[model samples]
Target: MGCDGGTIPKRHELVKGPKKVEKVDKNAELAAKWKYCALSQEKLRRPIVACELGKLYNKDAIIEYLLDKSAERPNTDAVTHIRGTKDIKELNLTDNPEWQGERRSAKGDRYEDIHCGMFICPVVGLEMNGKHRFCYLQTCGCVFSDRALKEVKTEICHKCGDPFQNTDIVVLNGTKEEVEKLREKMEERRRAKAKTKKSKKSKAAESASTPSEAKDDTEVDEVRNGSLENGDESSQSDKAGSSGASRLSSSFNGGVPNLATSKRSIQEMEEKSEAFKSIFTTHSSAKRTKDQTSNWVTHTPYHF
Candidate 1:
């Protein structure tokens, strides 16, 4: 159909074409990944931390997130794998001496350097500004550029001198494939720890069961012997009063004499020496008179 104003209709305008794809700015994407916290979306500052998935975050932001997980946040997916502080490691970053922090352009006359980074790789001196690939050691938390690691082959950390394995290296701000691999490794490590704990608990249970089983057997034997002894004592009960009383007392005391009732005091024994009897605190010589007794002193604040 022609327009009411009598303008000719173009073939291109008659039919709608396919929508053009929207492209993201590379510089802006790099700045977001390198200079900001993935969890909080705030500017990356000192005391930075990284998760098992190798995502960078501010330490304070991670703490705040852990304190109140139910609160509304911008990026919940970034910290879903982090259950506690143990899941993340604090990075031992090397400061860039050349890096002068963000200077505000008062009149838009000065040029702002977006490529400047606060930290640099200790090995090859590469600025970690999302232009170069950086990886951190899980064991030591020392960060180094991928190029430096490839050039200098060693099991120890370049900066901290701590020993680390190939598996301990986690790429910071890694790709989708790399993050997936790290997630798999994290799960594997957790599964191994859980298995070891279960094995230890099973071993402890077995050790505990063995001792109790042996104790039960000994108790059963003691009961059998006690029954036989009781039968023999019953036959001798009519023989004497002293023996019957001793048997009854022994039975009540687990086949042992009740020392409080049966045993006489050392002071009451006529055979004991007078000096030995006087040595006991309960003896008359050990008792203190009013004049000999020291003044009562209170050691504590409380009194009965």
Candidate 2:
């Protein structure tokens, strides 16, 4: 069939072919992964953190997400694994001296380098612009290029000098296989921590369950035995006589001890001087008869 205006029909326009797969720009993908946050998709600022899966994020973005997970966000899937601050580690990044940041070109005259990274490896001086593989130590949170670690070969962190094992190294923006391995390690660590907590709680419970009364009784028995061994026979006899009197008084008035009659009054002590005895309110000299005593009203509105 031909057009109404006598235009020639093309065979290419008549037959529709399969849709071509749209390819993402490599530079933009690199910038998104290395320069921007994985969760917020904003520029990665200071105090950057990474999850167990090695996805980079701005610390504030992660905090905001954790504070309200139910809130509407564009990238909730990227942060579903992060339950709290403990799930992520704040990175100790080394600044790239060559990177002038956003202040370099305001007039647009100077050529801006898009691949330039804000941070660099402390050991090998490699830029962290997604061009090279980078990893951060879980123990120290120090970032270092993969080449530096493989070349140097040390158990200690190159930046922070803290000791770390191979398992502690988590790849940044890692492949699917690497992420899977990291997740396994994370699960293992969590399981180990839970076991330790349960063991500690059990130990605490066992300690709490021990009878404290038995210890108190043993201490009392030791004290009594020590007193019996130290004192003479005459003192022991006097103590026994006092104990028999206290027992007889306790039997008369249930099991409660009659402290008033069992203990001597301070005012009636034979060794106390009359001056000292007069200071006490219970002394006979301090007593007032009914006629001498006034009404015990502390305060009254009516005056006599």
Each model's C-alpha lDDT? 0.88, 0.87
Candidate 1 per-residue lDDT, tens place, 1-304, comes to 5587889888789989999899999999988998899988999998999999999999999999999999999998989999999999999999999777765445668776778888999889999998999999999999999999999999988888999999999999999999999999999999999999999999999999999999999999999999999988876775677777887766785554455676778888777799899777767776656675546743321211
TM-score of 1: 0.68
After superposing all C-alphas onto the true structure, candidate 1 shows an RMSD in angstroms of: 15.1
Residue pairs in candidate 1 whose N, alpha carbon or C atoms collide under 3 angstroms: none
Q: Whose lDDT is greatest here? A: 1
Cα TM-score of candidate 2: 0.68
lDDT of 2 by residue, 1-304 (tens): 4588888878778888889999999999999999999988899999999998999999999999988888988789988888899999999999999998877866878877889999999999999999999999999899999999999999988877899999888999988898899889888999999999999999988787676767888899999988887776768889999999888776776555454557878776677799898777776766666676568856432321
Instruction: Write down the TM-score of every candidate.
Output: 0.68, 0.68
Deviation from native of the Cα of residue 74 in model 1, angstroms: 0.7
Q: List where candidate 2 sits over 4 angstroms from the true fold.
A: 1-6, 106-111, 213-304
